[model samples]
Target chain A: MGTIENILIIGGGGMVGQKLAHALAREPLTPGTTSALTLMDLGFPPGSPAGARQITADVSDPAPLRAALAERPAVIFHFAAIVSGQAEADFDLGWAVNHMAFWHFLEAVRQEHLASGGSYCPRVVFTSSIAVFGGPYPEVIDDGFPPAPLTSYGAQKAACELMLADFSRKGFLDGIAIRLPTICVRPGKPNKAASGFFSGIIREPLNGQEAVLPVGTDVRHWHASPASAVGFLRHAARLDTAPLGQRRALNLPGVSCTVEEQIEALRAVAGNDVVALIKPQPDPVIESIVAGWPRNFAPERALALGFRADADFRAIIESYIREDLAPEQAQRLRLR
Target chain B: MGTIENILIIGGGGMVGQKLAHALAREPLTPGTTSALTLMDLGFPPGSPAGARQITADVSDPAPLRAALAERPAVIFHFAAIVSGQAEADFDLGWAVNHMAFWHFLEAVRQEHLASGGSYCPRVVFTSSIAVFGGPYPEVIDDGFPPAPLTSYGAQKAACELMLADFSRKGFLDGIAIRLPTICVRPGKPNKAASGFFSGIIREPLNGQEAVLPVGTDVRHWHASPASAVGFLRHAARLDTAPLGQRRALNLPGVSCTVEEQIEALRAVAGNDVVALIKPQPDPVIESIVAGWPRNFAPERALALGFRADADFRAIIESYIREDLAPEQAQRLRLR
Candidate 1:
């Protein structure tokens, strides 16, 4: 049964949204029926797939959300927000975009559902982050670890997760907030996120260019390919949330390894020459910010729910090289 | 230098709020300076003391909040919300009052602080509840227990607690959310709260009236006298919140006892005539609700921060008798 038809992806201008859009375009929500996608962001996503209508608007404003709710899209993919470093630097903007926008969006959904005689609740896929967890210890943070967000961004995400559970429990909406691991080898120009280096080191080197390595080689963190993140969202959408109990958010499964382990995996796949393209440059700001983040997770609940991740850093690198990089550019880095 | 002067108590018509209003009216927030009190509720509270100016309005509404904020009260006690049973029965009303209203109030506070040239954040003491914990078996819930509220009321309180922590961290307001225990031997009326029977069984029996005892006598739960609850709020308002990092809410100290234990205490104080007044009339609805509630708490953080509660069930009963009932009523209850 193809339950999903109409789709709405907030923050569609971003990397994960773009990739998710591609995946959904390749496979219809209900095998045979192509899902019409409404993609809303601060800027219209470049090269968005067919059947996707792009809307440019500030997500914090409830007006656009109200208009979108009028169409009654069956599913909503909410990935819109200010990243951690930016949120910490600029508090108000972060609250407006990350917290206030989502609150307003949910309120709009509730209003519409009420107006429809209580039958217009849409399934919402909220992309949370591992930044939502921070602490004094635990080498492997399990699914049950309490969320004690150290940053404003994490706090906002945690708050949103609570709302998702409450709203879903009330039958106002069907929703899941998935805490995504730090996306490794993110294919893009580096932005302002403190965890940006997690991708930049892999991405820049893979592109036959120099990449900075901040912090120590021993720093361990969780990672997943872009494809896996999208897969987690899709799987969560079709999930039987009845078993979720009071916690609506789940820490999605991911590959957990230190930077040294990541480098070795790169060497095995792309050879030592490609790995050597990385340069060492310590940056305190990035180190401190990333240090407070949760190192790894035991995502037991998510794995039980059929969520998956890349087998290893090698698999993650291969996927990025195959999917994100140009073949000619990838071949040059291999030193075969 | 005294930091507190003017005061505002939302939900002032409620028992705890009324008691709080009386306490503030009797003593100054800052010694030698009488702090003016503004009491807001759905209806004007009776006998709310001389300094309190009662405003009959919805506490969740932003208009009255804005009007109150203009005065820049040094301390604000937010004790407003739909009780558990009512919230469960009326979902929409609960969301409106519990969630939306608090959201708007926070926004209003943020706006006021912004408009004040970054100097108008007040000490906000929000009375949260133990309903925030719905466990799958942990003998004693601790300060670090993750909030997984089972009911709509609990969900609302937990969400608000997160917001309080976030807003406080952002320097928007100085806030602390204290999760109060079930107020036992409650004065006046029996409300719709599922845990009201914890009070009803104790109150009615002492008043020489028949009391219905729902659920088994073995069901252990946390309890506090009205005086202790007020003490917690006062201590929270006056305490330096700098020690409380990201987690702003604390479970206030309370006496943990079972219904059988409570009955024994009632007999010791008011004699067998009063103890015999409790008749077992089990209601599955109330039984199930109370069963899901947390049995006891390890309020390590609150106790360490100097928050106190009654030593035992006898102390709780004695405090209620001494503070709430008239002298004639107390004498009659002692005889009974």
Candidate 2:
């Protein structure tokens, strides 16, 4: 038997992290090798993927994270961050969790690498966001577009990407920052993120609940299914980084559609009742924030690197239904 | 008279800082307004500009920086950094000084702002660099081009820009990061930066000393004179940041020229005897590093905001001869 690869998911309790953990549990990161999984977070939600060892700890405190790094995991998926709205509202906490903690984590990894006689470089997959690009954006943000983050959350993420790329360049650890699109059909309840309604408009309606669409139906955004996000993480871990060549941050592929198109897709999947659940309530605050977001991308580098996106907006909704729809929600949908 | 504007130059011992300090001593950042200047660095060279208070301290330690912030300087010109070559060689020192210190400094400013009942918002001018970009670049890198720093130094500078922009966005401080082109014809002995030869090729020959031309004459690079660098810092400090909006980082203008052009310009300014002093001795290490540097920029925003560049490469060379040529070197050139 081949050696078992130890894996660490830093924000493993979050939606994407849990999905990644479950995916890894089902199949090893590498096809032929067995792997052990460890998840770290402030706390895991109930019924988080079982069997994976959990380390309940705040990223704001570095002590616990340092202990986690001691194990020398082969692949470390770093997803810990304060979401956009919270980061914007609470600058200190955002900088603490999103920027400072990541700096400490990288340093800890470097310490581990140095202690191991320079042979313990791990694959670090950091989930950066499209928020890194501010408005006055191109019609299609190409690979060459600079990151002008409009929000503190974005600035923090962009800062992390810079560190990751530099550390990787210096050979401390192999790192790839995948600038993820808004994850649509995000499972569970809506959070305080200004972009949360992108998922809420879909998730809430599918669960037989009313959803608030704060911006206009004309509002367009880039999106990927939660499954694609997991796939991007895995691909980043296994892929050869040679092609990335210094520019380690990548804009991932996603479906670009207006809220109107999204509504049509929801109607196509779950009928008029589900579509009817979406209420258009124009919010000036969300409108201003959304205005600064990127509507589409020409993620040529990511696509060339074999990262795939959902086929279309319809396919995106279908993936959510297939992968995340709860039994009660499914029953409720059938009754409608 | 208006209230005296308190100014703090964090890297006041360095070349650009000293130039800025001298300029501030001569006049004021805002014409007709009295201003007080304080310089901070590890140490200052002999004969630094008079009339300004000097604080000798390493930026790696936050305690001293916090103490400096206690004074609540109204305008902070942050230039403290481990230069590119040193930063690349010493990873720990580079990140500590270049990235972490800046974070602590920003936080310290925030603390002061909070302590002052939210009234202390200082104008922060950060000296960033063109190194924030890497190769595979466009003919003229526009304002939209993202920073993909090929060196640890570049990454550190880019990270600082992010933090500064974020802090400014949150109204914690009014910040602007000006990405200066390579400062050419640097006075004193040549340093270890890969681009040192850019200045050495010009400065040494003018001083009647032999200098090596490591790369081919076809190599083009962006450059600004030391005087222009000070100008940029001062302009950034006084410029109304409203036009900057959320994107606080600006790409300053610079002279772009090839080595062949630089040599021709030197011949025009001096004579064949001086130009002949430049010998061709290829160094692969420097050649490789130089190849990744940006060659030109279309800094539209900065130009629109009234930040000017040297008229041409000839003007850049003249600025150095006028401001930095030592008396002994001038006598040597006269003898030649």
Candidate 3:
């Protein structure tokens, strides 16, 4: 190995973080480089990927974050945040964890840079979200569209993006904020996120369970699979940020489709029996929340910068089935 | 008099704040309602407006802000911030005052709202600036343009706008962040702001003093007068925010003109001798900084909402002469 690259993943216990951790364990961040990984979060799932040191700590407190910065990791992936639902429900917690913690973390990074005579700038990849965009949107949200976030979660994310860009501009760190679309077919039980049903309708049925469709079938949204999310994160880590100029935040490419199209893709992959498991239950609360979401995007910048999305919505379903479905679930699909 | 409506102006010592205070002392926020004004800042300028109580306090500490919020002022004008040049020079102080202090203030407001059983939402009028915008802009930046700030000051303002909007959405406060264009023909000595020369080239020359022009006359910029800034603040305090919806921040209208046009306006009003004091001595530092600023804007929302601007560039200069020129300065202009 040419060199040992130390990588840190905050929120490493989260789904996307674990997937990224596993991918990094399987391959080096760069050719001829051996990577050392450290994962930090409030807690980790059972049997998280091996070969990475895990630290259970709350980011809301700056002590642990400052301690972690002492090691001066070569690459830092900051994915730690309260989910949209929790953030909306608990305003104080959302601002403290999602926004304040990030600010403290950035300030710590700046201290490290200054202590090292400005040579310790690390590559920081932050996971911003599509919640950053609100409604009255253009048919296709282009790269130039402003972030008018309607939710506290989105407002926090957008604030982080601004700070990250400023810190990067001041040469404190090399940073990129990728606004990930809703990760579809999330691998796990349903959570309380208002957008959770987008994944529930697809993931639950594939596991031979009933799922609730909260909004109308015509309700459209932007989505990417967990696998594509990993790809975007890795690509962001290695991206030459020179092309991004001062606009460090990006609207990443994603598959945009309606709930009906998502159901059709699910049916095409798993057959009519699995599709029958989905039941319509109109949820006005979720409907109003989802209405503020962006249904489509023209993420020209990310595409041109070589960030790829799923081939199609059908491909999204296949990726989930291949990667997240349990052996028993896979067997049932095969037998069908 | 009708019921006394308590109003608080942060940064009350500053030019625009004093202008606003003077205006408020002269007239009530709403007819048929008596207005009681309170001004808070680190220090006040000599001869501040009468009939308003003054408090000396540092916003960097949350105690003073909390104490202020305890009174539950009906209208709050948050205009306090570190100027761009100073903010760019001192990163820590910039984030501390411009961003973090505002965060704490908002939190305090939320606390007051909760304490009052959700009945104490104040009308918060924040003085955001065109500095929130950066270059690579459209020919005419519309209301929908994203805030991609190239400076730490701009980024800080943008972050504050996000917090203000989110808080307003949660009904903790009824806030409006008006992105004020660069205030021109400022009636005072020039400060360290990179955009200072935009005012200096006019203010100094009109006062029978030589002014250094750092950039080319061809460099265009968007501007409003100090009088208009006060107007924007008062209008924001009285306007119905329901029409603003979720996007509580607005790009207020302004006059767009180049330095040459500004000089010509001066020559038209006073003769060539007064305009002759503007010396063309290009400074690259200010030039580079000003280059990233927005040149023009199409603030349709603000215009539609009845937020007006100076009729033209000549009108901007004329307003300064009419409102801010000292008797001695007026005498020199009359003789010219």
The prediction achieving the highest lDDT against the true structure is 3
List per-prediction Cα lDDT, in the order shown: 0.85, 0.91, 0.92
Docking class of 1: medium
DockQ of each: 0.54, 0.87, 0.92
Candidate 1, B4-82: lDDT as tens digits: 4789888888898898888888887677777788988998646878857888888666788899888888888998899
Model 2 C-alpha lDDT per residue in residues A48-133, reported as the tens digit of each score:
66679999999867788888889999999999989999999988899999999999999999999999999999999999999999
Interface RMSD of each: 1.5, 0.9, 0.6
Order of the predicted models by TM-score, top scorer first: 3, 2, 1
Docking class of 3: high
The numbered model that scores best in DockQ is 3
Please give, as one word, the docking class of candidate 2: high
Who is ahead in TM-score, 2 or 3? 3
Give lDDT: candidate 3, residue B100. Answer: 97
In terms of lDDT, model 2 sits at: 0.91
Tens-digit lDDT track of model 2 for B1-336: 666878999999998888888898888887777778889999998877676888899877778888888889989999999999999999998999999989989989999999999999999999999999887898999988878899999999999989998888889999999999999988889887888999999998888789999999999999999999988888888899999998888889999999999999999988899999999999998899999999999999999999998999999988988898988877776676
Candidate 1, residues A52-75: lDDT per residue as tens digits? Answer: 888888898778878988999888
**Model 2 CA deviation exceeding 4 Å by range:** B1-3
Model 1, A190: alpha-carbon shift in Å? 2.1
Per-candidate TM-score against the hidden true structure: 0.92, 0.96, 0.98
Interface RMSD of 3: 0.6
Model 1 stretches with alpha carbons more than 4 Å out: A1-4, A61-72, A111-122, A271-279, B1-4, B29-33
